[model samples]
Target: MVLYKTPNLKTILLNVFQDGILPYDIEDVLSLLVQKHYLMNKEQFLNYYKNDINQFWRDVASLGFKRDEKKATAESNDINDLKEYPEDNDNDFNIDDFFDSDEFKKRSDAEDIDNDAFKRNVSLIKDYQGINNSNERKNEKLNDICKINQRLVEKIAGKYEKMVRGTCLNIDDLIAFGNHGLLKAIDKFVPDMGYQFSTYATWWIRQSITRGIADESRVIRLPVHLHEKIMKIKNEERQYENEFGAIDASELCKNINMSDDEYWRFKSIAYQFDQITHLETIVGTEGDTELQDLLPITITVGSKSVPPDYMLTPEELFEKKELHDELENTLECLTSREAEVIKLRFAINKPDTMTLEEVGEIFHVTRERIRQIEAKALRKLRHPSKSKKLKDFIKG
Candidate 1:
């Protein structure tokens, strides 16, 4: 990546002008250098130029080390040393006019000009004239096409405006994006390809509009791969539903060739597009409770009946104490390792429980071996001899 520093636009433009670069050629060079080589978009380049034309030129100049070195050398020269070219003062000035002048004829006759130098100069003049004529004809053709197709451009832009109506972008923004696509199509489309202009332009127009929406419309932007997958899945689902009625989850997963976990994770992300809601949104005709206030609270045995508060009742507190004691007594009947495994697995002393794999790791045993030990310990506790100790609690 090239890290560019802004250059002096006046100095850069002066150097380019001194080198006899045409305005149209300068524009082409700027577009190619900024968009292709520097990795900047057209809009960003335009904005930079609009802000400061001189600064824009300077920055563009910085892209070339040779240009900057030349500029530095020129800047170091004395003002009296710099000479202006005749072309700088007059657009109509021609080399042919210089050759046709009486002063030039007098000098040539007196100096005895070399035949080779005269032939070379004449060839150079012809080449310049040919290039200038070709450019003029090209400009005229482009202008005529643009003038004739202005209405067609507007129509295409309007169509895309309607298509992307509900996006974060307004109709004007969509139309602007569509117009850019249309302009690019005009520049690239070939009549020899045997396709209608509209047919070729449609893809570019829709691509530009949809890309804008996909990149800008969402509150939370998804990764491009995920977004494409979600869109593909949606399209497939619609096709399947139309042809085969309601689709099964397993069949849908198979069609997409995704595992259960992957499919569900994608489904959850896709569903978020519809699930977004504001906290202050009213839910019912009553118009009293907001969505946030209506969110469900899990109701336990002694949970509060009054809004936003909770406390344990006497009876529930006593029942919980009894249950704790019975659990401890039952655990005591098992071997130490068995008891420890059971407690960790069930989260008896912690808010989160350990998995079978975690318990196996702690005891340096296979998961299946830990399962066997737990089952055996449970069987021993459930035997008639051990059952008598907790018979009352079991009855309750």
Candidate 2:
């Protein structure tokens, strides 16, 4: 429901020129004019302006404005000038030699003046009251321009403040953030870029306001980049649902070009911000059991019960005993080393089975040697004589 209005081109130009001089490069100003007013880029503007550049300059000229013919020619010949200063290939060439050359010496000598002494002499000139008065007038004009700009910034910020109502941040804070963005936009804006300043500044303003909300409104703060990504994912989800019938996780991942790990990680963080059940909320069918009552009570380490769920039931216990007796009789058929290895590997008494490496360390043999013996013992157990002893148990 928010309505955003873009400032007119004349308003932008008036604000820029109120200081009575162009603050940006001449090329930049021309480029902006070509884009915003003439609907052309720099190249096209140059072609069209070539014939009337002098007249154009005269129309825009103000105090201290003067054309630099030499500078303009140098700019036009920039590529050719680069060719004149080609890199020296010789590693032994002394760079200092160029600085000591006649051309460099002539340039330095022509510009050699004691800057401090010149300033001191100028300060001693009491007859130049007119110059001091002119400088004071310039300062006053600059102050007036600053006041006008300040008022404009406030007006723009006020509009944005209303848009962010009901957010955790107060109106004043929103305005302050918006004003900061406005100042930055003003500093970097190129009016001739075929766009209104309002359009550019609005983006900055909205970004600042939204960032403030993300930072202040969350119980657990997330990085700005993560928050922005979460918002983008939610928006994409809504768009996908509207276009397609249902959401497919793999398809969404492909569309966003995100890995499964990254998508799930962001989703988990976003879910933390959603509303959760309170401990006092009723959870059971009887309506008497609260959520907190259903939670397991924490027990101290010494008071913790040895989990009985893993213990064998009566029938299972009886079956296990019969199997153990059969295994013991069958193990007797193996060699002494093989019997020991089988018992240790299966953890007949110990809490956990021993690895081949552990059995090797105990018997003073390599793990490969232990493995070979175990394999040989298993082959022997599968013999007709030994197999017949356990055939009934296996069939049952």
Most accurate candidate by TM-score: 1
Regions of candidate 1 where Cα sits further than 4 Å from its true position: 1-176, 189-197, 241-245, 277-396
Error of 2 at 279 (Å): 10
Worst 10 residues of 1 by lDDT: 71-80
Whole-structure CA lDDT of model 1? 0.51
382 in model 2: Cα distance from truth in Å? 37
lDDT of each residue in 1-396, candidate 2, tens digit only: 100023343344444455544433457565655544533456554565563443344434422333322221111111111111212221222222222222221221111223333222222221221235587665554344233334444544455454335435566776676666555544444333222334344444444545555565454666666766776667666776677655555577688899655765666556544222344578868998665433431211111112121233455567767877987888898889999897888776455589999999999999999999889988998998888867767643
In candidate 1, position 292 carries an lDDT of: 45
